[model samples]
Target: MNPEDWIAHDPDPVTAAELAALDPGERAARFARPLTFGTAGLRGPVRGGPDSMNLAVVVRATWAVSRVLTERGLGGSTVVVGRDARHGSAQFAVAAAEVFAAQGFSVISWEHPVPTPVVAFAVRRTGAAAGVQITASHNPRTDNGYKVYFDGGLQIVSPTDREIEAAITTAPPADEIRRRPVHPDDDTLVDAYVARAATVRRGRHGHPRVALTAMHGVGGELALRALQAAGFDDVHTVASQFAPDPDFPTVAFPNPEEPGAADALLRLADEIGADIAIALDPDADRCAVGIPAAGGWRMLSGDETGWLLGDYILSTLDGADAATSVVASSVVSSQLLATIAADYGARHVVTLTGFKWLARADAELTGCSLVYAYEEAIGHCVDPAAVRDKDGISAAVLACDLVAHVAAQGISITDALDRLALRHGVHTTAALSRRVADPGEAAAMMDRLRSNPPAELAGFPVTATADGDAVFLTGGDQQTTVRVVVRPSGTEPKVKCYTEVGQAVGADLDDARRRAAAIELQLLASAQTW
Candidate 1:
């Protein structure tokens, strides 16, 4: 179809006007290719293009989702729609609900901005056929997205996503789908989500002064409420990031894992003499933690937090039925969690590189129960039974509880990390992201690494190689060693290289860190080149 055809059917006048103003080359670039669903759903810049995130793209995606659900005998079933506090989020969410309703589906629309996991929780809780979240997660303000969840509250896997893409390719025009007003609901679901998140607390600890940052996302108010409900009363929030701000004025990037993203929270923690600090991403599905250490206050790496929380959760459930309690992490995450789980007589599973795979560990494993799942990019699924996605709120509650319990015993989270390091032998990890100009460049980078992988990284020979959409060019598999995973970011134009350098705490933790850091730095510098 031509750009003129698209402009005629486009629902948003702003988009149509923009399309009309584009030159021949610009118009061809915008409408010649359509944005397809990737691992993270339909994400792109907020603009008027078939390849960008806009009203037409969202409407088509929503229609495709409805068709996919209805094919499975969910014609009249209810579908939940939620949005975050980003540009065009509410509008995109409304457009999605309208499309679903036009397709003879019931729409349970969230009128206000909410966390991404809230929509995931609502899908399972309501027994809805599917759910849609209008968000870009930690992406910049210029971008937005549409993420779909199937009946099991899990992100759609291979065939389903492919099927939805097929349906989207031939879906009806935006003007053909009838627009409908979204009916608002009371706070029943929100209250239920808060209650369920609070139940993750074992009532083991209380009264630890916590300084938290919401990263200028919509999770602040709800996160604060969940903390109070979980028996933590002394929670102080960073005022600059305490409210929902679409522009995210306080930080260069809204993602907590980004450098200096948690600076405000750490500063507030130091001022308030807080025991710990937690940072929730823009949509509050990924969590990053910080603690006051001997040198100063520093944010913990995703692996460090993963190990701490995994150790805590596993030990708490130690006496349960043997081989029943299970934990999961992404393939790119630290191997220490699996090692710990095995030593505790519990089962551990490693999935692909996202929460979409990590969240379904329990359903895939026959007999084991999935009590925990985590990724090295600040995503953790603490209570998968309640929310089948990486939930920043519940993870923070557990982190705060652990800090309180340890603080009561005259120790800090840093001390707990030291004990974990001594036991797990210092599994350190780092990520090297090389941003590209476009998705094609990202794919080219991945292909380059696969075709011509580094024979040796940091003086360690490439021991093994696994090639696919992502490539694992590793150096050691000595039960605990080094790895480099090269892949394209699902939702952004970036080729990412994740590196992990693990070593035993031979005589001193400091020595182990020194060795690991040297190896990690070399790997990172070389990884960045590719």
Candidate 2:
């Protein structure tokens, strides 16, 4: 469709004006291709064209989602809609709710901005057929997104995502889609989510001081509430970052994983003499942890946090049926969790990267439950039964519980990690990425790597190679094991390489850690060349 035709169909005058103001070349680019709905749902800049996120795009996408659900025999069922504090989120969320209501489905909408996990929890709690959240997560301020979760509160994957895209391709123009103005639902769901999140905490061990930052996102208040509800009263917050600000004025990027994103939180932790610090992404779906180091306050790598949480959660499940309980991690994550699960006699499954896949780790096993799942990108599902997706709020609560439990035992978080390293070798991990012009270039890079597998990476012979959603290379000597996984990032135009070097604990733990870190840097450097 041309720009003029798209402007005609645009429901929001703001976006229509935006389209009208675009130059001819820019207008042509906007209409050259429509946004593709993939596993992550629709995400792009907020603009007035089929290629961007706007009222028209949201309506059409919701209509397509409705059609797909109806075809799956979920017609007229309940659908939950929520949004974050990003630009255009409220309007886009309203448009989604209106479309769902017009399609004869019962729509439950939130009047206020909410974290992404609230919608996921609502879907399961209300037994809704689907849920839609308008959020870009940790993306830049200029971007927005539409995330969809099916009946089980898990994000749509594979065939469902493809089906939704196909339906969207045939959707009528935005103006032609029927819509009914709908009011937001009550706060009962949010309240219930908080209650369930609080329940994740075990018995109170100690009240360790904690410093938290929401990263100018929507998770701050709720995280505080959950923590307090779980008997964590000695909590301090980064005052400047507690409130939601769509512009993310403080951090260059909203992601806590990015460099210096948690500086404010760490600063607050130091000022308050906090025992631990936590940072949640914009949508509060990802959680990062910081602890006092020998030099200064340093954030724990995602893998380190994963190891701690996994050990803590598994430790509490003393007499449970380990045969039916499963803990999972992505292929790109460290394999120490598997060893930890083995120690507890629990099963561990490795799935492809993405919470969409990790959420359904126990789907193929009958009479089994996914007790926990995490990825190396600070996304952890500590309470899978409550919320199938990565939830920063609940993870924060659980992390606090872990801290309190360790404090009661006269051990610091660092000491707990050292204990784990002693039990299960020192596992060092790093990630390397190469940005490309577009997704095609990323695919081409992966193809080249797959076609001509490198014989050696950082002087370690590539003893084995496997191809799946990503290429996995395994090599090392008898004393150490080096593994790398390379794949195109689903949400960005970059080829990501995850590297790990594992060595058994010997007489000297510090030496093993230093050697492993050095090898990890080499592996990262070699992977960068590809």
Q: TM-score for each prediction?
A: 0.97, 0.97
Instruction: Give the per-residue lDDT digits (tens) of candidate 1, residues 1-530.
Output: 56787899999999999999989899899976688777678888999988999999898888888888888888989999999989999899888888888788888877789899999999999888898999999998899998989956888888998999899878877888776777867778988998888888765665888899999998989899999999888999999898898899988989998888898899999999998898999899988999988889999989889998888888777455437988999888888899889878888888888888888887766877789999999888999888998999999999988887777778888888888888878877898888898878987887777778878887777854765577887765553477888888888888888888888777778988888898889989898677
Instruction: Write down the lDDT that model 1 would get.
Output: 0.86
Distance from true location, Cα of 329 in model 1, Å? 0.7
Candidate 1 TM-score over all chains jointly: 0.97
| Location of the lowest summed lDDT over 10 successive residues in candidate 1 | 473-482
Candidate 2 TM-score, C-alpha based: 0.97
Cand. 2 Cα-lDDT: 0.90
User: For each candidate, what is the lDDT?
Assistant: 0.86, 0.90
Question: lDDT tens string, model 2, 26-86?
Answer: 8898888788865467888888888888899899999999999999999999999999999
Cα displacement (Å) at residue 513, model 1:
1.1
